[model samples]
Target: MTVISVHVPKTGGSSFLDILRKNYGAKLLVDYGLEATTALAAMTSGEHEIVHGHFVADKYVDVQGARYITWLRDPIQRLFSHYQFWQRNKFPRSPFWRQQYYNNFTFEEFAFSPAVRNEQARYLGGMDIKTFSCIGITEFFVESMELFSKSLGMDIELDNLPQHRVNTLSKKGYELDDKGLRAALYEFHSLDYQLYIQGLEVFKSQYSQVSGCLDTRFWDLQKSSQKSFPPQFSLQKLLAEKQVSNVIGTYYYGDGWPINMWDTFRRDVVDEYLDEVRSDGFNTIILLFPMSLFKLKSSNQKAHEIFYNDLVFLLDKIRDKGLNFMFRLGYSWDGFPLSGDRGRVAFSVLCEGSSKDEFIEEARQLYLIAETYSEFLYGFITWEDLLMFPCNRAPKASEPMRIQLATELGFTGNSGAIPERDSGEFLGYLEFLDIKFTDLFMDLAVAFPRLSAEVRVDTTPYNDSDGGEHHYVHHRQFVETDCDVIGTYFATYMLPEKPTLNDMKRILSFVHRQLQVSDPSKKIFIDQLLLVIDESIGKGYSTISEKVIDAFVKWFPEWLDANSIGYATWAFCDYVWDVIFNGTFRYGPLGWEFGGNTMLVESAETRYVQMESGAWLRGGRILHFEPWPQRGCIQIELEVDDACSITVELSDSYTVELDKRDMSQVSSGKRQVITTEFEIVPEYLKILINGGAAKIYRVGLGKEISSCGGRDLNMNHRVTSRLIRELNNNYGGNC
Candidate 1:
């Protein structure tokens, strides 16, 4: 069917064009010329689905099966808006009748002009107002579009249609408020007023027939789009049936650090790392594999062979060591040649193209290979890679890729431009990404049976039309996953740099609550429990203190016992490359060295109590502070007993003593923060007790001290090893 959209000026005609274009794509014709009648007469109904332009409705009235649609506004407001728009843009291509007045026209001159008066009626010509298939009201824009779609059967996505206001007037106020001017304008445009009233009546009658239909369909689509895949087996039930204890594990990617471990694979090195992992009291080892490795067309064939052989070798070794393991399928960290591109090309092929089927088939084949080590396999962790788009490029460079992705995800609209972040279309695009991510995890779950999807707990910011910003947390990946377990990483990046013990508790509690609300049936796991993270791998630079590490190690397992199934450290052993470090146990036992006599207490909370006067604990020392220009203040949180003064020393230069006088006077054991600033900050920080006993809880260094708390403190091998050993002894079951 051919549709003629008569675009009356200043009546939302440009916005209507977007809808027409989306519905017709290349089949939509624009006839903005002075003589549209000639073009209308020459065009065939089969050639174009829609002909939209600033033309009269009478032009296509005689065409076979041609229907009409147009938008109308209050004639007084429409004329003033048109005049204001002309004053601003003075569009050179405007109709010849408008060209003479252009920017020189005043509101009174434009409104009283005989040529501009009854302009809407002039566009209608001899055609009856009631003959239009759809007559949209500018005031009721959204509702009009809904009605238009239903009335014309135009295949338009009414819910996701974007508003496209063109040549908008910058004037804040219109002159129609003047009663005298309004009365005179109404009298001058009497013909248009009559036609607008008729069009409105027709619109209301047609809209009433389909009043609640759009809303109902919209809600139905929203409900259907929230697809969930429930796992065949419950993780909690499986753990109990297997008689396995809680998962106490750590991440291992060989000695080459962030690079693919298989590239530097050696039997002796693998054996040594496995031995240390077991000795550290970890019952499980979390291994990482890039999806690109399974892509048949990947250029690194030698790497693929080595990866397969090394994986089998490591799995057999893990079983021999009587340890359980889980595989983390990473989409972002493919390493080496692909690392620069962040595996975007491989991701597009495996997850977004026809090769997705092939990828899944190959994944199934890999699952079959792992079946030989099924006895030692706990599950696979779908690292938060699935939710990511290859967004490493500039927005302009990436827009085409995003558009192609939108098309692949079933967006039928012909909009070539990127949608605004807050637009319904962009949100729909994000929704489609979530659906695709969920579907991919579902496929993996079907193949592996026991799978865990690592969900991102961070919220993304969106700006509203009012220019106010708000955040939206995506829960679809977690809510719709068929994976038996839902996994997430824990790091200070999720909290303030100097978070207190309570702050840590609140953030984790919120994550736990959110996960429960997302899907109450699935069990939760901390796939990467980062006790200490380097600046290279995290959102910001930070250092973790031994006190903080001890506190987390003691509290996290107990908290997990009540809130989740288990957790694994981000890395068990540190891997260094140039200035970058990977794990907490980087300095062996030296990372936990204390400068003075301090008694370590591991009762309810982990802390260091002063054994005698002048006893001090070295919080953390940065040997090369030159690289970190942001380090400025030293902050320490501790409990001071009455009459006991604790001295916080920075690089043995700047010092500040805090006694009970500095306490908030709430309670005797209440934790108080003593922050000391420095002009030339030093690399080392220490806390010393003078004369009496005090409990040191946490210590940190940052650009500035904000409310006194921190994470990413330092810890050595001896400290972490003992902490892990104790956690496993207490939390680990049969494994």
Candidate 2:
């Protein structure tokens, strides 16, 4: 049996390779020459099978009655993912998607013209056309996967499957209109739209019966998996229980991605990694990765690598810089462990299958890889996209997968296997040791509690509250799924004309109430999140409306109330552009969620910190401050130029109907002094340190604009993964 596995970026290739060893053992070819095309020839020489890796076209030719299968995504999303690959590796440079909104308030540029995405598909042999028996639309993956498995007469358990490995920030997210339609039409063209429609057909076929027809177990496991052993008590309870925090104000999905960075560069001008933490509100940052940043890299490949490496170094350096940080861990293709990646290990699945590490040396190899940078490496991870839990084809079971993993550790005795990571049973295993791979991460978290580390790796159950894929389940399962489905319904329907900060807040507010009683792990996650905002929200920036601020703060109000979170809205930078162009982040009353960092609010409720943020007006200008959370606050001073007028408000308008109290303002020479204060609503109100409105002023005289926040959040701009990693490295976090 020739077991071939194609190593795509986010596919489940790793887990499949593990399966090959169980069924093929030594017969599996592990030599590079035996991979891909050479497999057919190699198989003739012996009673053997070839596990595949990175086999694009030629490998599957002329195999009599052989099953040919693969997965695909909407062309637009694929391009974005592919684009990110280059950006992370440094091929093309662009601002992150979100940052563009901050500066331009438009996602039109980053969007795929239907023509481009479809054109790529047409070139890729219509793979995007659902030409295979097991065509999988990643969005409805659970069902597609199950159907594929069944077609091959394989039984996969759904109880423990991982979900949403490949993530794409929707170009058409939120609501839309004629302007939106025309823009998409112009940008995407007919070909891309056709691919999308074809893909939609596949999505509807298998997923209509259930939300995603994924193993319903995902919902259950998502909730049941992590139990902190003996039920952790409190911050007081956790006096004994240990924790972890993974921050990702800046995570690199792939290439010129985050296109927001270019603008962030122009806006924030990120110079160092810690500088990024400063850019994101300091304290600590949890940077995430998948097997995401692979060979091709991004447009700024060298620069991105430098940034990534700088961050690795900065993880430790942050401790020196007097800031906090975290290290996030995740796999490239799905939540699968990259260390066990067969493609990287042996270059192909066949080679990997034939060369099973009798002792699974990969874990040790992983530790070594992680150990290179002793400075930051705060903790392990569950990629942010992992939140999109449960698809129609959610894994059938982890038992088969677990059994394979057990063998990796050389489980000689039938009692040696442990529970599978996702689902299914390692029936032979009875030994439950504390030193499993889980321990590797747990040890790191405990050793660095200051970083408040934790993993949101598993798609805990089908929660109605989460975002992305898991959230999709609620609608698909309840409303209707058909062959014609092609929308993501992001609660945008309830939005108003000209959304305001209050409107954004109301929306996020609904998200808040819906998620009020998060699982213990999520609560812990939020705390560390707040701690992050408290320490560093000062120097970095955001450029959304007061409504954007309201939306952001409302989602994690607890952190705000706890004085552990803050934000910078990049308003100062936007103001400069606004002055130059007569524009503002204010949209609809407050709907200004652009791409990338434009909505820079991740893990806000995932960790703890003591932070405060408020906007002040003096000399007729507005000045807002949001601190990172999980830590306490301190007073600060600044200097300003003469001839500027400013007015400071304690809060943004769309949310938090303030009792409207009056307070006194304080001042200094050119710079004024403001202290973060707690409000009756609990969160610290904005301090009035407004330097007043004035023309652009220069600080740190020679710092590069690219080294600071961009002049504005450019839609195509992105705060590089390099910068993000740098922050983690300095603050003491991930790789």
Candidate 3:
């Protein structure tokens, strides 16, 4: 029982194919390209319930008891759409002659071309119009599909049979307003116009005969299938039965920072770093590795070996520090060119379509390495490195990628048809990438059971040919991966400018909901919690004030605890390359000294001052100016009792007092901001905090005074690290 569907170009066949696929599933064979006929000849009857693609009707006429079907459109409109589609999308499989004709000829020239004059009729070939079991009119696509479904006893629901539009043109049709051109096109496509009219007549006749038949078949199929279908696996139930370990983690790239840290591999530095992280109450450490380190290129072989050894050493050190470790196996930018030729080679390989195999093989090697230290290994994470190109490129499917995608979409024959950007098929292409990514994760998960699959949280916006835009978020990876944990990044772009506590909460809540919608059972881990954003480091980042930083540190952890979610700072320590602002107090309290009755209280969060009425905290080197020096003002954030007053003195030249009138009520205490002027200097600036009983949280200096406090550019890292540590102590459970 073979159904041959001849999918003539620009005849609404692509959309129709989706419905057929849903109805027939694996039984539908997409026979595309010139080789389709030969491929079909080799297949036996009943092997495929439906054979659909771009082949002439006569090609399948010999099939025993086969039913032929096709859709036809207005010849002039179809020609115009086909031309527009070709202009937008490159079809490598298109015949060279056809490509040349379309590339060189005008719309009028193409419409009058003899080779494509009667495309619809030519596709039907020697087959008679009345011979088609079902001739669908593209104009009435929904009704035609319904009729075709009923004629074949396919049980397709009428309500579900919506018209699927693909490769749509901006213009509705050829310039029919040009009467002379329209008349010329109509005359040239007389045979196609006649074929389309005849097809429409056949469609109307079939639809009339079946329109009265109650659509009970679909309901009947649904009822029977429901009984036979197996129960779906419930992730929620699995999660309810198991205890999810809360992860309080930070990413470690070693002392060299960012790229090629293994190059300067120092056991003492890493050991001390891991010890500091462990002492700070971090239970987990995610090691960041550049993909370039694992490339099999001869030039990088020695570096690869060294990296492997360094990784093992770090694992041993992490185990000694009693910290759990996870591997993040792909950071594409290793500061290429500036870093060295090694990064350049790796970047090139990642961009190439042929390097997918190498990428997978390298990942397998990483798994092997982790397997050796499984005692400390929590799982592996992929850092937006699943695709050939980095996320910034907005990569399209290359020819090889499309060929693989053809197989993924269940196409049986090679087809050179590339989907137009923003078309439904193009969306499918993005989904196909997600599937490939999940497949890779699944492969690794088999060996390491506790994998965390990272979801691409950023939505890609695309404008259709009609000047309409839509955004797409890839969630297929979250939905398909069997891993128990899902990973995502929280960056500045996700928040509003000068965000408040409510804004951060709203954004995080939205992200969480989006992931939960995909799969409710999987626990989410904020693998890269980007607390401090530098606009100069990355594009489209928003700056936050010290007040926002203070609020985030206090509230974000509590929110995570209430929700049973976990997170890791993106950069536990500042990177050498200054790619991102540091997210830790790694440098400690560098240049400050306490005096009088002021007592410095040090904890896992931060080092702050507890002062008495006569206490004073003075610092000769309160702020350092690098590269050059300039005049500026100093701002400080402090908390005190309602009646308390604090005086800020800068080099004994300027002074400001913050009293109960200046303070605002907050959850912690009455908070106040104090700002004072300073003079230009080539050395560190001096400042003093004296007078009333108060607690100082932050001190900062900058050229101008705004509402925002200007702390050390890296102080946000201290706030971030402190919050993470606090979260870990309060909620992190043993895995």
**Candidate 3 lDDT score relative to the true structure:** 0.58
For 547-664, candidate 2 gives per-residue lDDT tens digits of: 3433444444344333212211111121112100001111111111121111212231211111112223111121122332232221222333342233323235412211122113
Task: Give the Cα error of residue 160 in candidate 2, in Å.
Answer: 28
Off by over 4 Å in 2: 1-228, 231-281, 293-311, 331-497, 516-559, 562-735
Model 3 residue runs over 4 Å out of place are 1-244, 297-300, 335-354, 381-383, 388-391, 394-429, 442-450, 459-471, 475-477, 533-539, 562-565, 578-721, 730-735
Better of 2 and 3 by TM-score: 3
Error of 1 at 717 (Å): 4.1
Top lDDT prediction, candidate number: 1
Give per-residue lDDT, candidate 2, residue 230: 21
Per-candidate clashes, comma-separated: 11, 226, 1
* lDDT (Cα atoms) of all candidates against the true structure: 0.59, 0.32, 0.58
How would the candidate models be sorted by lDDT, starting from the highest? 1, 3, 2
RMSD (Cα, Å) for all candidates, in order, is 23.9, 26.3, 23.2
